[model samples]
Target chain A: MDAPTEHLPNVAEALARAVDTRASRERDLLGELEALGAERERLRVAILSLEAQRAALDPIEAEVRAELTSLDDGAHEVLFNSLIAQRAAVAARAELVAEAARAQRDAARETTDNIDALLVEYRQFRDVIEPTLPDLPATYRSVLKAHHDGVVSRLRQFFSRVGADPVPLDAPALDLDVVIGVDGDGAEAVGVTIAIPVSGDVRAATLEGAPELELTLAARVVQAIYEGLDAIGQPTAVTAFGDHRGLLVVEVEVEPTDRADLVDQLLGIMEDVLGTSAELLAAGVRVRALEVPADHLFPPEESSDTLEDAS
Target chain B: MSEVAPEELIVVPLAVAAERLQIDPFEFMRLLVMMGEVPATLQISEALIDRVRAAAGIELWWAEDVLLPTDASPSRAIVRAALRQLLERGFVGARATRIDNLWRGRPEDEALLRRAVSLLHREGMVGMSRSRAGVVVSVSPAAVPQLDAAVRGESMPAALAALA
Candidate 1:
């Protein structure tokens, strides 16, 4: 072995041999891989054939499913139509009942409204004729209407004396709405009772008058009545005594309260309107302060007092 | 320190010299004896004060500049420089003296005194004295502390006392 010459064919020759070995192994691996690839191709083709068979049966399967679905749809449509017809029948019956209820309600409302209208008419009728009814028999509806008229007349006379303008009787004045019972017992004597509103001041001015002036005003009242009756053509025959004058000796009737009001009305009329003063010139004017026999001529009717009382 | 005769020794108190020169006593002594206001001994008395006062009235003398004592060396230049600085700063003033031995080589030292007077005026420490002399100056009740403060550049221990 005499040392193989020439450096054993250089490093390139050694590297080329190793590459050729790797290339041979790679070619053998390529051959085996080509065989495996051929087998895979066959298997893939078989799977493709099976997939084609499954695809070929898809339409028949879908047709059968569709036939079943149509059967179900036919049954459901029958049931749904039957239910819709039943619901419409029930709703129509309920609507008829509701319409009947609405008609009944409308009739009830109309009946209530007609009753209210009749009540209003009756009230209006009552109001119109109530005042005249008091002059009728005791069986008349109520006595308030006739008594109200008398009070209203007195209030008018009071205002005229006090320099207040006469207003309509229906004006809203707070007054006692009196109710006077008619006797109707055929003596033809009509008795009156004043209602006298609650806590009203009928004698307030008298309470404020001095005792002497109160007596003096009473005397003046008697004189004025005598003079007023005489001036109105009801010639009053007055009889005089010691410090006394009698307007009426017999059949003279007047409440002290009423006489006071009458006196105030007369004096107010004289002083406020005519500026003429009237005085008593005496002490207390007692109804029985002086005695008189029944021989005097009495005042006839149509005197202002009689006329005012009649009204 | 020779034992010279008393009259020749000029034994006037330093305070009298200060009054004559119208300066602070200590400062006048510092300018006269210690600093050598003269090259030779000189007499000092009330006559010297009269001389100085007459010179002050005539406007012929101001005492602060010439009265400073100095060394025997010939360094008159240094003394002159210090005097010039003092004059510029208003610490000294010049005064005229007799050229003979009676008042020779003594500089008037009225700077501190003039300043003290001005300070008194500023502090309202000088008041008018109604004497025969017209508008004479007398010490006001404030003189003690104010003058002391002006001299010492510090407030005095006691304030001005009320006059009896």
Candidate 2:
């Protein structure tokens, strides 16, 4: 029995944010925009306050000096004490105003520090939300695509190990399609299957009207790819068939990465085991790339045994 | 179809009967149908072992002689049938083309036969002769041992030992 995808929260709506990478990017842009607005406002207010303090510094100093000088100039036996007291009061009020402004600047600095920490968390929030979001078709598609590429990369490494060069292919163009399936009662996709299509052609005879021959060839190709994959320590479940047009289609259980290059490598193995292209053509076996039915691509792992090898 | 083996008969399918007799499956099908061994529907190709035991000079497949112990390919079986047909009739043997004409598109058995013939010839199990017979193929002297191993599904080294 398969495990339900309940652990993947909001799975049906998984790609609500993750799928549209543009949306997450837009969110990042919004965050940066907000940070910019806040910092700008902070700097603007701080700058205005600094200007106000600088402007008030001169006036306060002049007022204190003028009052003190008057008290000094008016020093007399009876008035001296009262005038000096008034001077001390004026100086204390000016110092209190300056100290309050300094405290306001310290408070502004602390707020900026808090905002800085918030911006760090906002970026991390983007990171945290992505994987926790439910998985959707696009998630599988992208991962399968990577897995497909990894298979090609692995194949290339395999060839390089032998100091041999394979017939280069635009491997990304090779199909490793992920098929999303929704259960009968489930509202969204719950399962996936991987498809890898291969083309089979015969130079001498047509397999179009010959279902048995097509199936035979299809079986051979499947055996070839299966062995190739196993040789690389990448054994996987597979189902393959030949179509009415005598083309071959393969489905494999989903994996973290693909061994898709086995399809390409298989032609080489077949050519070696069977013969050269001309010899193969004479024997009515031609391997190439082609399309397959989307409807048939995603059979379950057990399906390979059920295809009924009529050959 | 008058001959009968001395051994007890066992239940098996017509195809297995054909395999056991070293005869082509289609030819065996025809032989069984003609002798009223196969039903009209043709869906049921199963019959008693006695039906096949009734067809040949020898004690037939499972009778006190060696019967091939493994599942042989249809093509290999066809090749054997061709040899048996010539031996029964006391002929030198027939041309590959003659077999092709008789078997074309009948389940694509001709293609299989062609590959089989090529492989057998390459392995020196089929001989070519000229002159009085005027260019025809006959089973090589080594064919029996080689084909014995062939039908038994022997491994390459053991099969090589058989030829050696």
Candidate 3:
């Protein structure tokens, strides 16, 4: 028996998780930015201190100059030379301080640029994955649009859904067999079942409006449908139709919750997956509600042992 | 944005992870996915993912059996699927197609074209047909190995391995 537990969290939970993750990342970025700013300030303070020392030396140089002029000619020359030497030393020290400040500022700018790059990457990643966000990052949306548009073109060129007109494709054509169904309660949600056929040259085959085909051809059709749907997060069931041609029809069924939007989403995903230039002209594929009725939904009663006995 | 401590933000590069595991970056990523070390919804092509996993040191991908280097170049979809599996296993952080261009094909590579089509058929990942333009491969989750022997290959003990 399955243990009873709470159901999975809904869209709200998903949104909350996204928000929390973004918040944490933003905080980290902010911290790095602050550190960079502080380092720049410290460098500026050191530059100011050097300037103060240079200012204090100016008056001392003037007083020494008067004393030098008052001494004997040889003694006066020595005093003047010493004072000039002291001024030169102070100038060199100031230059070193200024160089240090310039280096620090450059380093701080680099640190800020790195942080900006990281933040940009994070933002792009967020836009691609989060569905609830009002808009996606520009690059992501562009890629999706190009892919989606291509898929739509392909869908229109080949297959027709219920009540929709089929667009023409100049290439050799084949139509896949699919079983459509909905759960009991007349749900608008529908599913499709497809059978795989044993053998055929699909490239050479012409559209015959047949519901079944040889074993190989059937398999190829099912494989195509499966690939198309899986790309869009929609899946179908494939099963053997009968032993006559080793035929199998692929089936895809959606549940009640997504029933309303499933077809549109499926169509969109299929077009994207095909990456074709053909347009999808039809809105829906007219499926008989009775063909694969919900009443036929059964328990697993057909035994392999029973089949073996019959064979 | 609030301030975060320096220790809170850490970057893990693919090359660095590959080196740490003593394998190619791809192979290590596969091991991570199979181990369920990351989110399950992450999507990537299987061929690239398998290559990455193999590069990272995880040998014995299913694609190894069905298609050879001679048959066709594995498709980007296969690589993406492998990446998705890796993400689920927590071997890598995440996969974004825009960020991961390593597995994408270059022009004029016919071998990659054939191998990808064949792999797509065998794995049932995508239902794309070969055309004059090329083919599109389906991306799906990597199959989890059911036995320790299957995973450990010839050189290592299965018991030492971790399963997510």
Taking the tens digit of each residue's C-alpha lDDT, what string does model 1 give over B1-164?
12332122222333345444444322222223212232111224433444443432312222456443343322332222222322333322122121111122233323333333344445665443211111134344445444434333243212221110
Go through the candidates in order and give each one's C-alpha lDDT: 0.32, 0.37, 0.34
lDDT of 2 at A271: 43
TM-score of each: 0.14, 0.19, 0.21
Using TM-score as the measure, name the better of candidate 2 and candidate 3. 3
Q: Write the per-residue lDDT of candidate 3 for residues A35-136, one digit (tens) a residue.
A: 888988887897788889888888998889967765434532343243234323323332343344345535544534444444344445445634633487
Off by over 4 Å in 3: A1-179, A183-192, A195-245, A252-256, A263-311, B1-164
lDDT by residue for model 2 over A192-287, one digit each (tens)? 221212232321122222212222233333444444444444433232222322223333332333324433344454444323322123223334
TM-score of chain A of 3: 0.21
Candidate 3, after superposition: displacement of residue A250 in Å? 1.9
Identify the runs in model 2 with alpha carbons over 4 angstroms from their true place: A1-216, A234-248, A254-279, A283-286, A290-311, B1-164
Give residue A295's lDDT in candidate 2 (0 to 100).
32
**I-RMSD for candidate 1:** 68.0
Ranking of candidates on lDDT, top first: 2, 3, 1
Give candidate 1's whole-model lDDT: 0.32
Docking class of 2: incorrect
Query: C-alpha displacement of B32 in model 1, angstroms?
Result: 99
Between prediction 1 and prediction 2, the one with superior lDDT is 2
Model 2 scores a TM of: 0.19
